[model samples]
Target: MHNIVLFGPPGAGKGTQSQKLIAQYNLVHLSTGDLLRAQITEGTALGLKAKKLMDEGLLVPDEVVIGMIGSALSANQQAAGFIFDGFPRTTAQAESLDRLLAEHHTKVACMIALEVGEEELVKRLLERGKTSGRPDDQDETKIRRRVTVYNTETAQVAGYYAAQHKFHALNGIGNIDDIFAQICLLIDQHKPAVDEAPAAATREVKA
Candidate 1:
């Protein structure tokens, strides 16, 4: 299995790139943000708890997030691998994810972080906000706060993966296809090779 963590702050084009990677790699895309929203939309017990915390502007607990991921993994047993997005925001969460993947006989092959300048990120997010209808993206103050929160709190997760020699950084600028090509190169390097088919048997006829 060639599991990957697609790491980036807001407006780093993770969503766009993830789609391409999923198509090229045949990997399951697991976005915690999407998973939480699905649960909430379905009114699951876990979703209710998450909704309460989110309604209060508080972050959901890591265990809850881990549980959601576990369920996602269970649901996609035939997947070639997974592209994890918007997850493992802290070192603790990273450790938890490692354990979870180990239970399935796989480990994170690499974590590819999209490095973008704050100015560019701000500009992209503000422009997206015009059409995204996302309140957090629309307000400059919220955008800055989100970036600050990522830097101060979430950026350390990179170190967790780095210590395991699974962290890689990519410049997240210029043409989309160009960036994707670079990303594909890196993934191909880290992804495990597929098993070769067994040689056909040669039969000896008895006279």
Candidate 2:
């Protein structure tokens, strides 16, 4: 399996690149933010809990987030692999994810970290807020707080993956296609090769 974690702060183009990577690799795209929104829209019990926290401008608990991811994994049993976006934001979450994947006899192939400057991130997010209709993005203070929180809290997740030799940092400022090509090169290096159908068939016949 060629599981990947697409890591970055807000406005780092993780979402855009995730779409392209999914199409190119036939991988299941798992965005935790999207998953949580789905639960909220569906009015699940977990969603109710998450909603209360979100309304208070607090993060949903790690266990709740992990539960959602577990459910997603169960649903996509036959996927080629998964491209995980907006997840494993903490070292604990990273550890949990590793354990969960190990249960399926697969491990993360790599974590592609998008490195973007704080000022550029702020500019992109503020511009996006104009059209995104997201209150959090609209406020300069909130945007900087989110970035600061990422740096102080979530950035350590990179070290967790790095210790396993599964972290790759790429510059996030460039032509989209050029950046994607660089990411693909890294993925291709780590993704396991699929067995050739003809070769497998021949072996079965000989057997």
Candidate 3:
């Protein structure tokens, strides 16, 4: 599979670009937040477990999240590929994801990150808040905190992928179509030539 781990801080246009990429590539959207909500809506055991932890003001364990991802992979055996969003927040989670995908005889095609200046992100988010009705977006302090959290915590995950020659970064301040075109270029360059072939595991990917 030509799986992708799409990364960006808030207001970086990830949502807009992801929609285009998904439709263009016919990739499954494996957003962890959405998956967690699915589990809760379905009343599954894992979902119940996650919801309980969330209600208790505790973070749900990685295993539960991985379990949800594993189930998703199993259920979508026929998917062209998967686009992972809001997952693998740590290097440890990245390692775990590698192991899980290896079990399925497929691997992540690339990790694409959208790079934007913190000030621009803050401006964009605050503007969005005016229309989005999300109080968190309206608060500059909270917005900065979120950006700092991404830099200190989630950003480290990029290194794990980079060490494997699977990381790509792009400037996010550009025309929407221009940015997406660049992202597509990178994915096409790195994506396995044979998506479903058994030999995909050993395919050479361009850095």
Candidate 4:
């Protein structure tokens, strides 16, 4: 499996890029935010617990999120691979994800990071806020805080992947298709080569 970790700050268009990658790779999409929000919208006990923390821009507990991911991996065993979005946002979570993938007999092939400046992120998120109706995006203070938190808490996760030689960073300021093309190039480079077919036995020939 050619699993990938779609890494980037908020408003870096990770979600948008993930859709493109999924189409290209036939990979399953796994977003921790989406998973938690699904439970929240369903009013499950876990949802109630995550809602408050999520609204305040805090990450949900590693164990809780990991449990959900485990379930997802099991359900999607037939997937070619998975693109992890909004997950492994912390070093602890990254370690847990490694263990989980090992159990599934697959590993992250690469972490493709979309690099965008803080101001650009703020600008993009504010524009998104106008239509998204997410309170966290509506507040500039919260947005900046989220960025800061990402830098402080999530950026370290890059080191974990980098140590394993599986991190790739790209400029996120460009045409959407161009960015996707660049990302695909990187993915292509990292993709594992398939085994070649065995050669047929040669028959004796007249000399």
Q: What is the TM-score of each candidate against the true structure?
A: 0.88, 0.84, 0.93, 0.82
Candidate 1: residue 129 lDDT (0-100) = 91
TM-score of 1: 0.88
- State the TM-score for model 3: 0.93
Q: Over the stretch 104-139, how does candidate 3's per-residue lDDT look in tens digits? A: 888899999998999999999999999999999999
Which residue runs does candidate 4 get wrong by more than 4 Å? 39-60, 195-207
Tell me the whole-model lDDT of each prediction, alpha carbons only. Answer: 0.82, 0.81, 0.87, 0.80
Model 2 spans > 4 angstroms off: 43-59, 194-207
lDDT of 2: 0.81
Candidate 4 C-alpha lDDT tens digits along 114-143: 989999999999999999999998899999
Model 3 regions lying over 4 Å from their true place: 197-207
Which residue window of length 10 is worst by lDDT in model 2? 198-207
Instruction: Compute the lDDT for candidate 4.
Output: 0.80
Residues 14-95, model 2: lDDT tens digits: 8889878877877777778888988888888888889999999998998888777777777666667788877788899899
Q: Which residue pairs overlap in candidate 2's backbone?
A: none
Clashing pairs for model 3 are none
Model 2 residue 39 lDDT score: 80
